[model samples]
Target: MSPQKWDENHPARILLLKEMNEGRIPLDSNEMGPAEVYYKYHSTVEFQVEGMEYNSTFTSRLRRLREQIRRDQGKPEKATKTKTARKKKDVSLTWNENHPARILLYKEIAEGRIPLDEKEMGPAEVWCTYHDTLEFQMDGVEFNDNFATRLSSLRAIVKRDQGRAANDRKALEKAMKNHPVQELNHRGEPQWNGSLAQALLQQDMAEGKHETMRPSELWEARPEYKEAFSRKDDFRWKIRQEIRTKKYLYTLEYRAEEKLRKNLKKEGIVLPDQDEDLDGVMDLEEMEDT
Candidate 1:
């Protein structure tokens, strides 16, 4: 029940305020709207798997998402749940529900405006289909630029995230190569210090030092991207080589000019426009080789 539904002078409201002051509870009475929370209870849906009882919103959402994907792929949707299929905690739920980009996408999905085969469609295609609608309409409210960009670049963003995950995994494997799991273990047995390893892995992922690149890092990756990165590197190398060659040729010419001036001085040959000082080698060097 909403706190607003109760009388302002109600004992529960007074108790809620007291609870807020105590700060023992996760919720703040002043922070929460009346309808936000009355009784601190969680709602869960029970789904049986392997004759074991489990209840979580994560399972329900994954079940729904898989079915949706299967339908999009022109395959029979898995309406029935598997007995052994269990849902781990949702890694995306916390981010997705609160994310501005996905929030806009979900709004479209909730409105039934998004096609069922959205999985098959790219973000550009989705944007083109609802470009005018999303760009202008927000229930007559002004369009938000942040939301607009997110809605437009939705698919690309998801693809990038997927690539990041793959890259992060690869990075973890490579890191573990040197610091073997057995080495990290105290007993030096086959047992691995998973907790420590996990922490390190999370730190590296957060730093994004090994995050995958698409067209830019292509040379180190796929054949298509290889050409682009290699081509750029080759161009840079050629430029550096040309600069080095010019520097070498210039150095050689300077030495040759020095030798020529020394020889001329030894021969006592005072070519035209003689300078009072003998140190004017630059002036002599400037003379044309006629």
Candidate 2:
């Protein structure tokens, strides 16, 4: 691990933005894989962030790194959702960036052109504002309000995932507690804490319930093992499915918490204990401060 060598205009991040703009890297979870960008491009900046590897460093901090670059330049955080404050601090998205409509929407909101509670605005409105409703392509995809919405969702997921992974422990703990299967060894014998719990669970799913089993007898066990046996040749898919499920559940919980906070705020009840990031994104590190 080394200290971060990044400032507002670090070449590492500049290269990343270049890669992002060039379509070499994608924002969708569906596109995650062993990309050339991960190996070739990521190496250029892997030394900047401490302990983060070339493969994971960028995807893990997709949104935050950009925001960090902005902050390092002495720019203010994102604009306020509050109409009154928004007037004082006109926020903006990068005009030359891929997601220009999002900036336009925020600017519109800041200018009081749209109500805070306004229903979803159409993508056509974005096209109309920018190009007289002319259809266009951006990053090889049709540019419309739907793309804007997807951009927001992807950004949200990136931000949420980039936050401390520990913040998601509640969901993991719930799974471990509520799971019908208990810890078991490869042989199916029960093992206590300090063992490889995940491997044990996979084995349990493979063999079903068994009071007594041995690692040597694994092949002779039942064929209906749901976890390990079913996905024997598809370990990658299993891991991806588990990761996606975990992220989805964690995101649902985060959204619910956001809703509760908003409702409480209307009643003049600010939960000081749950101060989100200045940008209104809840970084797990920030959440744990209180």
Candidate 3:
């Protein structure tokens, strides 16, 4: 019901005021606040039938009355200017409902899908969890940034708002840094053994990491490969040995197709005619083994 519909002595006003006084309700009496609880009650069947506004105008009346009562009793101001200024700065840092990222994050927090207190969660872990969620759009808001960037910004702002400690932030940064690897064995490479180095090389090959050059030329130009192999003769022997294997040949083909597909995709080209053939040829199971 509208504030005009009720007297100060009305039971609705009395009960609402009681709830507010007991700290059982939010006095979200401002236009900017969500006032979720107020709206929940205002949307009751009786009030709905009366065509009450969901704009929270009723709470403004309660707010003014509460202030008047406090002033009459000679109560001091609850918030200091410094505190108010800090709050204003925090509000500016926070994303509003209009931000596409906020639309998803707010929904997730409200539904308990994601933790409301970001300070308790590690930033990287929270970021990982929000990756897929950030990809979704709510209420038709368009997101210009990619999912990773959006989640990164959202998480940082949340941590800032919660006053995440400097040491805790340093801990988060330490966790995000790449951990050092231990070379327990020295089969060939000083930094990495033959098995680990070969695995890394094969994975890179599968991902089309190298430019369009012969394996020998790549081995000569890339220092990592020289470190991994230790000798050009050994590299040559290994390539000749691996090329006989079915998995090796499949990996080469996969890298070639991946390179072509990526280049074509950048130009907005699709090979519709060969998509079925490509799908058939790109055996994921074999690629996984490679």
Candidate 4:
């Protein structure tokens, strides 16, 4: 083919040039002479099947396929990070019935008033005063600064009265005759019994029969009476026992809700829709977890 035709894009001419350049075809003319060589080449062309003459054709096809694959497989986008919100902690105060200040404070709260701080006299004295108020025979009295102070003074008086009563009882018992008294029975001539001695002792045991006394009375009393009247330790032991027996377990559910509502109201916090039964709204499972 002409060079101009070869450059102009003829498929057959391109294939022939490519085969000759790849050394797949031999170019020797003297061995076979021109006529025989031409005939032999023609015969070989008719009988032999053709394949890719060079590795470049295979590599070029592979490069095109790889480019196609890269185009089809797109780049992945980056993921965005998320933030989790933290849960809020419960900040409510829990008051127990057994707490010395609880009853007094709760009483004031129930009466729509606030209690004064116990810092002035001391926590122990304040607690004693609160306890005295429980047994104090008064109506419509409210707990405040003045009330706490007065209650503390009253507790002292009650303690003193208890001591005096115990002292008076011992004196009366000692003065009673040691011998048994003679008494006639329904069907007997005479009977010897300690009924009089027992009666005197029982009379001394009666409550509210003795006048109030001070803390110093036991020591300040006559020397002979000191041994009989000294019962401060016994009284303290009894008081401790009574406290253990009388202490009540308090349920916090209703009280907690009421206090929470009151505190929220004071802080201007608006609550969402609520169940009428507050107990039902609280999660028992969560409470058990705590």
Best by the lDDT measure: 3
Ranking by TM-score: 3, 1, 2, 4
Model 4 bad stretches (over 4 Å): 1-140, 177-290
- For candidate 1, the lDDT comes to 0.39
Per residue, candidate 4 scores C-alpha lDDT tens digits across 59-95 of 2532343343335545232233222101111222233
lDDT, candidates in the order shown: 0.39, 0.45, 0.51, 0.37
Q: TM-score for candidate 1, please give it.
A: 0.22
lDDT of 2: 0.45
Model 3 clashing-pair count: 0
lDDT for each residue of candidate 3 in 138-237, tens digit (9 for 90 to 100) = 2222333443355556655656655666778777778767554555435735553346556666665656653355677868866767877777777766
Q: Sorted by lDDT, highest first, which candidate order results?
A: 3, 2, 1, 4
Could you give me the TM-score of model 4 versus the true structure? Answer: 0.19
* Winner by lDDT between candidate 4 and candidate 1: 1
| Model 4 per-residue lDDT at 139 | 21
Candidate 1 C-alpha lDDT tens digits along 1-290: 32233234544434444444465332311232221222131121111122211122322433443344446556674454344222211112222333333455655654556543446654556655553331122112123554445554654555566679899999999998966655323433222123442333334434553244322342343342232223546424433343344445555556554544443322222223323323322333433321
